[model samples]
Target chain A: MLGPGDDAAVLRAPDGRVVVTTDLLLEGRHFRRDWSSAYDIGRKAAAQNLADVAAMGADPTALVVGLGLPADLPAEWLDGLTDGFGDECALVGASVAGGDITRSEQIVLGVTALGDLGGRAPVTRSGARPGDVVAIAGRLGYAAAGLALLLAGRTGEAFQELTDAHRRPRPPYACGPGAAVLGATAMADVSDGLVQDLGHIAAAGGVRVEVDPDALEVPAELTAAAAELGEDPLRWVLTGGEDHALVASYPAGVRLPPEWRVIGRVTDGEGVQVTGRVEARGGWDHFRD
Target chain B: MLGPGDDAAVLRAPDGRVVVTTDLLLEGRHFRRDWSSAYDIGRKAAAQNLADVAAMGADPTALVVGLGLPADLPAEWLDGLTDGFGDECALVGASVAGGDITRSEQIVLGVTALGDLGGRAPVTRSGARPGDVVAIAGRLGYAAAGLALLLAGRTGEAFQELTDAHRRPRPPYACGPGAAVLGATAMADVSDGLVQDLGHIAAAGGVRVEVDPDALEVPAELTAAAAELGEDPLRWVLTGGEDHALVASYPAGVRLPPEWRVIGRVTDGEGVQVTGRVEARGGWDHFRD
Candidate 1:
């Protein structure tokens, strides 16, 4: 309930527990000033951390930001960044509770997000069982495709959707607690490449996850962009990152909400397996040959 | 309490709320690798933010770090930093809850600390009354003097203690809640310059703060160092920052713990005032001619 201007802000943790997560975004590594506005970077930073809170099956509460800025940077950029953070928090009923700023060589963002479990057990990454169905909510591969498009000098009106995806991701925040309430066994945020992230869940839970590509409809936009760029749309769907999508393993018999798509299954083994998309010959295991 | 390796950490907030604060430390502005070791930087970063939590009348529970490191940074430095964080947390029964690492041009540390209030009302800086007695717990002016010594290229063995104070500050974490229990009307961490931070408490509380000069004992080391450097020791005591000392205002009749020293009083006016010392002739206020 407490806000900024104090030494620290106090957030109500009604369930007697607080869920906390943090993420760092560097200027050149995570975002580029020419490609994304400060507002976009702020939104993306908040989204990724907030999505992590959701992945824990908690309701997002507040975010505290630690920002590093160069002295020559414009003040309007900071205003835009603040507005972006506030708008993103508004989307999920959360607020920017506190922040600290310092001078740096380039823009650096450290966002810490907190949440409350609301009496529900947190969904961890190591709880998947052999018979569970792997499901995901929110867009996948969009941000990666957007990044690729921006890198290719294709930031025209036709590519705006993909570029916007890279600049500001719209994470499905509510689906995290929703999945938890529905008894999701294991969960994670798809920030890293999907296959790499799924591998984490598999390794932690001691179970193999097999993806069913048939369940993922390659979007028309993705297909058109891939065709023009000589890339594989399905590959992006399988291995891209930064979508901040929620991936969870639910008991096979449990009914999923409308927003969730059953894209895979948990099995008695280790490592990620993509059905109907064998790519053992590729330099990288998950990429197309 | 849940640890790292999950989507987010779960920390029990027994009082139904969590006190949270964040701070950003950049390489050139906040610390220099040549002057402070990675371990020192880590400990200093943690101490500053943890002290902020304690200043809110809470016990530190956990910390989440967001680190942006140069690719050329040594692995041993990272290890030392981690050890320092863990050791500092161990001192107060807190732990490292979660962390994120990213590539950056320079080292950037963003630390978010959480705390538990233990059912006590938070001792905010706006609660001081006209009759309150101002007291402080922890060192004053030591770090500032140390910094001056280092900047002057006098980091010899004789100045080790003073230099060390600048490298690593020891804040009295327990004094915050302890002050609250003893009826502290207003409290804040002396992070910014003492008079400047007191100005914050004064403005927020809408009462004038009259600092008693006789109450502040200029350390002998500071006096000796000031003589050698041709500086004023008392000025450092009155305005230096980064000691992270806990300064609070309590009812005049309340008995403070032994660690606390009465240093000032709340009076019927606005702005910060120094008793037994006036600087009306100085070009700028709060300093001697």
Candidate 2:
């Protein structure tokens, strides 16, 4: 409603800088109709991109979407998709601006998110100095646990929690701007699990991150679900992805955001470790094959 | 190479504003491998999106691409695609700052373009006034002519000109920023043919546009190709699309750029007409079903 009719939507950037990020979600690849509803897919897609903006320690401001749908798709499907996008944007006080529509064999949604930096330098992944405290602002293993439940042919009320997490990831969007205000040094979103994403910060900052298993604050439900499935809960927290939690490192004695909890520390080493020991594996790698 | 290893790329917007636009190109729907090489398809896709930035009367600054390719796709194909994108961006002094890559069953390219306002008011399509001189920059009907030549199975040097135009459109990119500085009232890019694209401006501005057929500078090859195919060259120029040319209207006596040619004038009426008569048809339309 706030001047979305213009050529480009106007957004306020108190720090005189904006962070922009985009992602493409292709049907049958990123999501499946059998697993994700039209509405759920829309919210998940928008959330993932918005989470990227938040990972930069910026407040989400606006989003522009380009959707390609097949000709046979029902009009109601598009309406539901738009409704989902609007619902998610409304949560952060952002608007869904103009978008282009074209015909394709499969549904493709391209989302671009705009963010405002609120009077703080962007907390990038390249500032994790040695001895910095690495903290997280949200869950780590829920989405992957949800995926496990779905794969196990589980349904009904007993599996609803896992299903909901996979359908719509509730990333810690507000904590990103809050962490930036609190003076976090380096940060990234936990989209590709804790270990893989932290490895990005580690490589960029030229330091190793030592995560402590005993210091983790994982939810009770994830632990129960992993126990039921005869799996390691720590593996779920370390390797499961798509939670989009904000993870950052701060200099010693720097005040941390209320939602953030210390889980690790930066050290003068080559890679990431768990409790002073390096893990042999990590999360998703797009190009390793 | 300038600070490209980050979660988000920074672009300078000296005027405190930017013109942003996006589009998606899906394989088998937007382009065919048999007709266009990977490089040509990439160039065409970039040209189409860059034309949108030009339509807003802004100079293109940077592009962020989201590429989805199948796992089996050769690395060389990606190389060709990136080379084409780099070539086009280099022409406008722009760069591909950052992008996301994901695996998919088919090729899908989601392109977002950012631009600088250059301290000039953006030329939108809602400001055309009666008596404004409507003009166009760049070639018209060439791409359509090329498609026609190929469809009719015209081969060898006889149809080479038409074939080339369809493969890659050479838009007048600088004319967009130029028209903005010259006080053009309203503007759009001619991607959906002259008459069809102009119809958008006419409908949006609530004015009629009268095109002079004799004033048109049709290419000699288009006329010759039309004769060989037994089609109307005038119709091709009026209805052929995908040239990505900039079209705008100026106040009377306003000096126009060298590349721009006066084609028509705005009138106090509805719809667009050719010379003194209204045409019954034009170019591509979605939802025709």
Candidate 3:
């Protein structure tokens, strides 16, 4: 219920712990003004940070935003950005509790999302164990496919959905808490591609993550766009990022939520393998990519 | 005990509520590479935001940072920035809880500080009443004077303190909770100049704030700098910002903490007045100044 208009805002942490995460989205590196409206950028920024909170199996509670704007930016764009933040926060019953604005040469957004654990222990990536089942609970390559379509100038009506996914990822916010309730051992958000993110889990858990590529149900939307672009849809699923999917490891025999589909498993070893093939370093590396 | 390397960080909010605030600092606008070391920028950034948390009468707990850097930025600079953040947070018994890194056209920092109120009510700006004594904790014009010395290229060892103040502000972190314990009715940090920030408290509290210039004991350093620059030290004390001093209103007869010095009083009016003169407009306005 706390709002802006003060030096700082107060949020109730009934569980005695707060979940916090931050993300920075720069104008050219994260999004292009030509490709995304201010509203799209704002929503994407909020979603990415909120997804991080969700990945911790916490209930999103509030967000503090730090925005940098060029003086030449239009007032309407700022208004639209505020609305986008409001709408995205509304999705998880959170509010823009406080924010700071500053002048910058280009648009930059720094968002910190706070969450409540509701008395549950946080599920961390380091908790995965051998023989655990790996599952995912959201779209995988749609955003990447959308980006491909936009870059290829394939903006037909049939490809509008793909482009929209790229502009504003619809993360399955409930899946995080659901997985935690269902006894997930470890979890992470697939913001940096499935294979790459799972690699983090594998590295932390000291186990090998082996994905059966055939188990992945490539959505028709991604496949059609891949076909149009003469690209392999499997690569998008394996290496493309920004999808904001929820991936987790659960012990065998635990009843999995219907939304979570088995795609891989944890085994004795190290690193990530897709169908027994070690994937080359891929996904988003801010400096290198 | 929780730190980085996770999707999100968990902070113990033992008071059952957390106070949060965020600030964005852009290169060339908030700090200059030529004038400030990366460590200086980092410490200043942390100080400003942590001061905001303190202004709310909370004990600083943790900070989440979002950093954007050009690809060519040296690793040593990044390390220095990290050390600066860690050192500043250590000042308030806090930690750098989590952070994100990204590439941008220029360096930018988005910092969010969280605090625990320790069961004390937040001293917001809206609680001042007529006849309340207005007091300040910490320096007033030192930072402004430092900025002046730097701008004038007065690099003599005599002016090094002022220049250092400009590069990094030292806020009175404990004064906030002390003021709250002393029954402060309203409070704010003087980040946007004393007069400008006092206006915020006056407007929020629906009372007039009147300051006596004679009551302010201008530091000799600021006075000397003003003499050398042919400027009025009072102007820097009144309208120059970024000092980050804590100003609060306390009911008449309430004993103030030793750190707080009475410099004014609340009266029946609508805004801030310095020695019977109403400031037309002063302080930093991001879009305009």
| Best candidate according to lDDT | 3
Q: Candidate 1: lDDT of A45?
A: 88
Clashing pairs in 2: none
CAPRI grade of model 3: high
Per-chain TM-score (chain B), model 3: 0.96
Model 1's CAPRI class is high
| Model 2 stretches astray by more than 4 angstroms | A1-16, A276-289, B1-4, B276-289
Lowest-sum lDDT 10-residue window in model 1 chain A? A279-288
Number of the predicted model whose DockQ against the real structure is largest: 3
Better of 1 and 2 by TM-score: 1
For residue A77, what is the lDDT in candidate 2? 89
Give the fraction of native contacts in model 2: 0.31
How would the candidate models be sorted by lDDT, starting from the highest? 3, 1, 2
lDDT of 1 by residue, B81-135 (tens): 9988888887778889989888877888889999999999998989999988999
Error of 1 at A69 (Å): 1.8
Residue B54 CA displacement from its true place in model 1, Å: 0.8
Tell me the lDDT of candidate 3. 0.88
Q: Write the per-residue lDDT of candidate 3 for residues A38-116, one digit (tens) a residue.
A: 8888888899989999999999999999999989999999998998998999999988998989888888889999999
